[model samples]
Target: MGDFVKEILVKPIQYADEVVKLADGAISFRQDCLEVKTKSEKLVSLLRQAARASGDLYERPTRRIIDDTEQVLDKALTLVLKCRANGIARIFTIIPAGAFRKITQQLENSIGDVSWLLRVSTPADDRDDEYLGLPPIAANEPILCLIWEQIAILCSGTIEDRTDAAASLVSLARDNDRYGKLIIEEGGVGPLLRLAKEGRMEGQESAARAIGLLGRDPDSVEQIVNAGVCQVFAKILKEGHMKVQVVVAWAVSELAAHHRKCQDHFAQSNVIQLLVSHLAFETIQEHSKYAIPTKHAMSIHSVVMANNQKNDMDVTDANYRNNEQDDECKSKIQRPRGCQRIVKCTIW
Candidate 1:
């Protein structure tokens, strides 16, 4: 193929990357932008795989697929621009919410076309899969193929792709302990840890949920913890939105359940303080005439472990019983065995 043709074929993939970047920057319809970003990423992956194989990318079938992909990406780019604009002043010119639905379906169709092209296009017998950056597995099990695909997407540069991959991993991990172990074995934790820090709030929440489910195997949960999941979770718990905070709390609880080693690791990360702030009592300034509530700060582990045991749990204290005490209140947190702390709580 001529240089011009190769450049023509490469433009769509480049455009897809651009779409992924701008989609993440969208200030409105962010979730829909994520959908656009994920689908565009799939197209990029599929198109690159097709190019890497020995198949003639400039041939009619591959050329047609690239052309269609570019058209879809053109629409996606337009949509992303509108989303970023927020359309507040667009009035009659505003893009409809359903526009995202149509664009996503078109992108999905393009992805399917590229996948089909990759499946049917014959490559040189000596082609090395390593050059393609895709698993060359020819397995009968669809689940195995699915797992590898998601793992590859997990390693993608965009948060939307990683978030989508993590959500899928959660589903796959839930199937059995074996798949969960396989995910960890395949080194999915590194990107996930990156996602926890770099992804948007929605993506971070999904990553945390997936990390918790992957902790089903205590053996591999330690791998995640050793990869600094505690530090990441602590950061999220400290700074992330409340929904994400709750998810990370659950993951922290899962990891901490495995060993005292993990708990100590979390303690060093100061996750204990972040977790406490969640269950912290209302401050005296928030409400003056409220009831004398009994609440205590607990580690993420203790908070989770104490949830079901809340009926049997109690706070032992010598602090002021007077609801109107102006002094700081100190209380003894009594929960499960091994989880006892003197935590200070406010009276509401």
Candidate 2:
């Protein structure tokens, strides 16, 4: 834990402290900057607690959470510094209020992650209790607690429960880009991806769609892709319920269009080729009113493929029967089966 903490978490903690100082030091955008500062301060405290945790601190997922937290802090610092600039520097900075809001959302997610880690880590933070309660939510982002609740349901709930949770997640994510990124930062990708693979049809579709919407930034994209999104998508496209395939198809397209690098990922995953094979039999036309978008287009492709195979078999059987009939005709003629047969042929 000691070596891993120094290597993986120390730098991120430093970055968080830097964000705190920079946000506090910034003169302009004070209120917005302070929002970031307060969040960073909380993150630092949480991170320190996480560092002392006795569990497998070096695990890949743990490292990822800490690493991602570091990234948000770095972003916060960059934004705060830009806000700190004055005169010509300030002119070039062009800081926006929404930028701080987005960073804050990410930071709160980091705080939540560390808090969760503290609860699960061995010997627990409290030494007496095996589980620690979740940290309180920010007053400004009260919806965050609800978002976290749905994600929790997605993790361990039944099929119908996960499906409903997925729909709730999709709705919150669709409300704004910030909320989408927030879901990503809160470790929603793992369970969402799991549900996409194993849940009921309704759950799979919602889970797949939510994943696409979650790619609100490069960092989130990295998290989603690294969570095996491309592989999962490729598998589904090749052999999932046709309706689920359509949802995944739309998901892949949305992420690719949102990021050029994501397009490269699909090609690497061979999903692009899979999509082409699908398109050969399916039309591009789509309608939105169905339970799954593009349901009609894909349904036709399945029907067409089935019909084509049946037609080919039918033609082969017909040719075989015709050859048999010709053989019978020749045999009868050769055997001189009846004088009436010969007479009929001559008359014709």
Candidate 3:
């Protein structure tokens, strides 16, 4: 019985340690790549914490920690792949074709190795239905029905699953107004708003994109406003990753375009002020893509100012009308003759 328990528990702990070491090796291999290094370091930190926590005799590895570790590793792998692809793209433009091919092959092999390690480290029970809710629909099921299912996953899935589901929903909504509308109608806004506010980096990124895409639909704008999306977007614009900030700004622009209420909310939330501050920094202005969204935000600011001025004028006009009516009423009233006569005598 002791041997069986050791085999069941000790081996898996050893496997997890091996996985952590492999992740550390990958981190060292990509030390020069800051983005890759940052992500890998996070994975290492999470795995180490998990390992330490699991070592306690009275405790078992919690599902949340395991899920979080896997998610971090997944994000690290993605960053590694993206860094390699970017390197390849840059090298291909300057290097000989043979050299390019060799470099590409090396990158592919490296990515494959990391992918294999990730798979080996992942427990066999980590299926889509485990992290996500409910199994996928049968092949015979109608496509239209899948929308609700996807929304359900977005609402209830684990962090990583919710991120993917949000990305999938955005992809479906792109160029499809009907799908965007459906997402709003199906109660997707609340979950997305929460994700944008509290999710991990990837989750926030996907949620921002999804919200931005959905904001393009006129009907969805009010739903987004009621979800307090302006506050989330404002926070993202101020503190999110640069790529995500651009998307959030664009979404703000879209929401400002057709909805007066959204515009007011954004203005009141100080999103316009944040964008204006961004514009003052030379680094932000150097990125041309950033300018596009900043421009849109400034446009919203202009509209807000114009609206305020108009409101002020309207109030002034109303006050003037009231004053004029009061003067007319005073003119119609007869003054006492004795008072007038006393004034004439004093003057004489």
Q: What are the lDDT figures for the candidates, one per model?
A: 0.66, 0.71, 0.54
lDDT sort, best first:
2, 1, 3
For residues 1-348, write the lDDT of model 1, one tens digit per residue: 434445665878788988989998887789999989998888888767766753343244455557777888888898888877745444444778689999998898787767754543333232333233222221245565566556555553356666777888888887888888877876678777888788888788888888888887568878988888988888887787766776777777766665446777777888877666555532322332332333676556444444534432332132234554324333424222111121221101
- For model 1, the stretches where C-alpha displacement exceeds 4 angstroms are 1-138, 281-348
Off by over 4 Å in 3: 1-141, 283-348
Worst 10 residues of 1 by lDDT: 339-348
Q: What value does the lDDT take at residue 328 in candidate 1?
A: 30
- What 10-residue stretch in candidate 2 is worst by lDDT? 333-342
Global local distance difference test of model 2: 0.71
Model 2: per-residue lDDT, tens digit, 1-348?
466765677888888888877776787888888888888899899888777763444243466567788788888888888878888877777776588778888988888877765554432223453343443433356566566656766764567878988999999888899889878877788889999989888999999989978877777777889899999888887888777877777777667655668767777888877777665433322221122323455676456555555655675677687875554443532211232232222222
Model 3's lDDT to the true fold? 0.54
- Residues 1-348, candidate 3: write the lDDT tens digits: 223323333333443344334433432234433433443444444444434433221111123223333443444444344334444464453323343233333333333323322332243335333332221121233333355555545654578867877888788778588878877776778878888888888888788878878877566788888889978878987887766665676667667665656666777888777765554442332342223233344666455545555655675677677876555444643222332222222222
State residue 344's C-alpha deviation in candidate 1, in Å. 14
Error (Å) of candidate 2 at residue 224 is 1.6
Judging by lDDT against the true structure, name the best candidate.
Answer: 2
- Please tell me which model should have the higher TM-score, number 2 or number 3: 2
